[model samples]
Target: MDPLSPVYITGCGAFLPGQPIDNEIMEDHIGRVGGAPSVFGRRALRWNGIARRHYALTPEGRWLHSNASMSAEAVLRALEAAGLGRADLDCLAAATTQGDLLVPGHASAVHGELGGGALELASFQSVCASALMAAKYAWMAVRTGEANCAAACAGEFSSRWFRPEFYEGGALIDTKGRLAMAADFLRFTLSDGAGAVVMESRPRPKGLSLRVQWIDMVSLAGRFDPCMWAGASEQGRAERDGGWSRRGPLAAHAEGAIALQQDFNLLKAVIRAWIGVYLDKVDAGRIDPRAVDHLLCHYSARSLREEIVGLLEATHAMIPEERWFTTLTETGNVGSASIWIMLEALVRSGRVQPGQRILCIVPESGRAMVGFMMLEAVEAVR
Candidate 1:
């Protein structure tokens, strides 16, 4: 198989579970769950720069949907946009930090929701960068002629994992208190959503499509510890885990609830991950800063976005303020779904045109992973 076979993202879609929730509603939820955020938590919320986020749970805290349901819906919309159906799919790859279940894989759940398609299916869990990593694999499958049509998607049911009761259960005491607080800080910033894109070996004529020129991802875990994490740990490990959870400290096993844990060096992590990756790309001649037409980034905080933009401009005269794009403020950090949401917003804004270049940067703090893609928008081939 030729390594250079063309692959195109012919269609994209997203499903935001419910109305966007604001800080006020968030505060009310916390109150109802029996925990008042500490000053640090409240300040962290304000400084996080996310005003609203969509969640799958109701304000009264009801489970409305799972990752599989939202992802299936988004995939259908993407297939519709691509002018194709499930039968056309050669493969389906689903990614998420939060899956509907632990054993069967998110892809299986999605396949069930998609009415049991006869195509290939798989799932990935790599923290926040899972979606793009899945997309990269999907592109490879098509480029290698393993599939003609493929879908890469991610959906996160983050709201269900949040354990407000744990916070209110007097976990905030002594040195462990600040870690718990930081976890709450992250919980407040996370929202639930799903996004999907349909990729094809060939593009349709006279339509919008994005051609992937190149994409690269690097793990900074060994170099840094952002440690923004949730979920279970080795039950018997010496490391006491972090994040929100319903399981008490005395529980025999890890149970329901999302655990939030983070180190305080988030700003440093952002600088190192985002800026460091871009500079490395430039140094390796993989990217020409001046050739980047548009810049899309996943920075949950406004300050991080601004700082990255400033640093990039100072380093290379490439990205301008007008070309920078994100949905963080309105959508909050929808985890792995963020990049696709930003792409959709870019398309809706009508700022992108055929032959224009787009550079998307994604960073995840769960042990620090950074992924960036360089692509060119093109008129579809018939």
Candidate 2:
């Protein structure tokens, strides 16, 4: 990790559909919503307390796509909204586990636009640890005097699926069945969009001060990899070519429910232990351990998010009622873009005010990275 001070977020902007996906109409999409009480109203009220969410997706949320480079366009819009232009940046960077392309990252084109500037181009990816890494790199660059300003952008090029089957490519599930369809299109909770933050050494009049104290990381390699993927095989000529190359959180050719439960338990324990240490470290911007305004985490499934919500409530790290972002219900699993999406929600909801401390816990690669930052509002140009 690059050594840096508690950096500040000077400018912030995001793109979600101007309209929101209100819960009142949720059952219209999910099978579970059908038999649930209030049909739509009660569940909408309980669906993570989210009145509506933004999306850069189609009306059905069944397919995944945007005008190519839509996120880049979002960056332009975000920067303009933040009162920043190519002239004001020091670096252009983006993070993602799932990207449209691997070599030339989403930032390459963004950097290309800032002609004649001294801004460097960088890309960081760690499954779900992307945005934090990108932001950390930016903060370090500013603190080390490497750059006067930087743009830390993050977005997810999510595929249309939720069954956890495609994690290992093989046969495709027919999207015709209700269960199969739900498995494929679960990103409604996530409005595919781009978000950017301008980081600077000198605070501008209308910038958001995102004081990041520290970022800690630990790995449990060979842990969830097995749970999420399998390479077992059958004895056949066809199997020789196709077997042992499969992946997923779904049951393997031979994976049993017991194995699934054990793996799930391990992941849960990993999160609990890390947060235990994180919470014990120090005060989080004068807020009570139990009073944490919200918990922004990587986009996990609905059951997992609820499970974590219970855990946070039990440990008093955050109140259950404060679970504001539910990607499972909307965006499916956003891979690495989950945390940034939640942060955007906070900004849009007007819940994150100057000096409000928010905690973002990113659990990926069988490890967890904890980021605690304090937000200070920036001056906006009329």
Candidate 3:
């Protein structure tokens, strides 16, 4: 078997539309609910600790469609961070569960908006797990020598289609709000946003290499399938004349409840399997699970995070004190972008150090868990 060596994440960037809304205003919009805040509208992220979120400005300064606007900005930011340019791009992979539209993938539209990159490109969507999946795909491309550098962008536009029926099937203009009205809760809290990560294979610079090695995908599909479906609403019915449909919120929430359970079970299995393989097959080098210093995990729900962090106290899978970095208080759940966002935060905070092993575990459908265990690289001595 081939040794999946570590791939370096050379750059990272994120973008939120301007005119950020604070938690107070966000609470007000998620709905006061008869003088009391609705329990779940914005409950998922209130104390997530994000200061503000950005959205786009229309001609009249309104928020634009979440995916396209945020995606374009994020890609540019990552490229700049890598000290590279569009000219250096070898591949572009756009990932999003909430896209600009159902028929035409957001990537095609975003590619056009970016003045049409000359590099090869594609789109990836695995619901909330897109970030890790996208990253895995990008890293694989480089690992296989298929590309020199790859960029993956994930935008969480969950709010736009809070009502799966309307978002997936069709949408009707809301006479009251002048926007789609299926989920009133979404309008207030779901800020349009995007995040991007640049992956490349770089030399070790006379020291330990910053690398991503061994991404294994494990899927636990049945638990979350009932909650997963294409959104099909009345407006969508009207738009398609009964063309498509989406998963309802109740089902979504049910799946949400179970999603983390499935994620945890599957992640443990994969890690054990990886270690077992190292001992039985690749016996020369064994990775000490304890050597893992950072774990970037997929953000499922606020409660799920609380439970896992509490339970994993011994291994330091993560800590409750780090909830702010895990749950995305202000950002809410940007689906596939969640883990990448956390990883990005660590990089920006300067917490990740050379030789420190970081494990980024992301969960996808069919019980697919992508694990990227990397050894940090020594930065160039300036």
lDDT of 1 by residue, 64-177 (tens): 788899999989988888899888887999999868886899988998999954878878897778888889888888888899999999988877756555544343333433
Cα lDDT of all candidates, in order? 0.75, 0.51, 0.55
Error (Å) of candidate 2 at residue 73 is 3.3
Give me the displacement of residue 177 in model 1, in angstroms: 9.6
Q: Quote each prediction's TM-score.
A: 0.88, 0.64, 0.69
Local accuracy of candidate 2 as per-residue lDDT tens digits, 159-256: 22222333223332222212222122332333355566777765555645555555545454423232221133222112434333354324443332
What TM-score quantifies how close candidate 3 is to the native fold? 0.69
Q: Which ranges of candidate 3 are over 4 A from the true structure?
A: 1-6, 27-61, 162-191, 203-209, 222-224, 228-288, 313-327, 364-375
* Predicted structure with the largest lDDT when compared to the true one: 1
Task: Kindly list the per-residue Cα lDDT of model 3 for residues 41-134, writing each as its tens digit.
Answer: 4543542335555444332333465577678778888777777787788787888865776667766766776775476777876665566567
Q: How accurate is candidate 2 locally (lDDT)?
A: 0.51
Q: Which of candidates 1 and 2 reaches a greater lDDT?
A: 1
Query: In TM-score terms, which candidate is top?
Result: 1
Candidate 1 — which pairs collide?
A: 161-258, 243-259, 243-260, 244-258, 244-259, 244-260
Q: How accurate locally is residue 310 in candidate 1, as Cα lDDT from 0 to 100?
A: 70
Give the local distance difference test score of model 3: 0.55
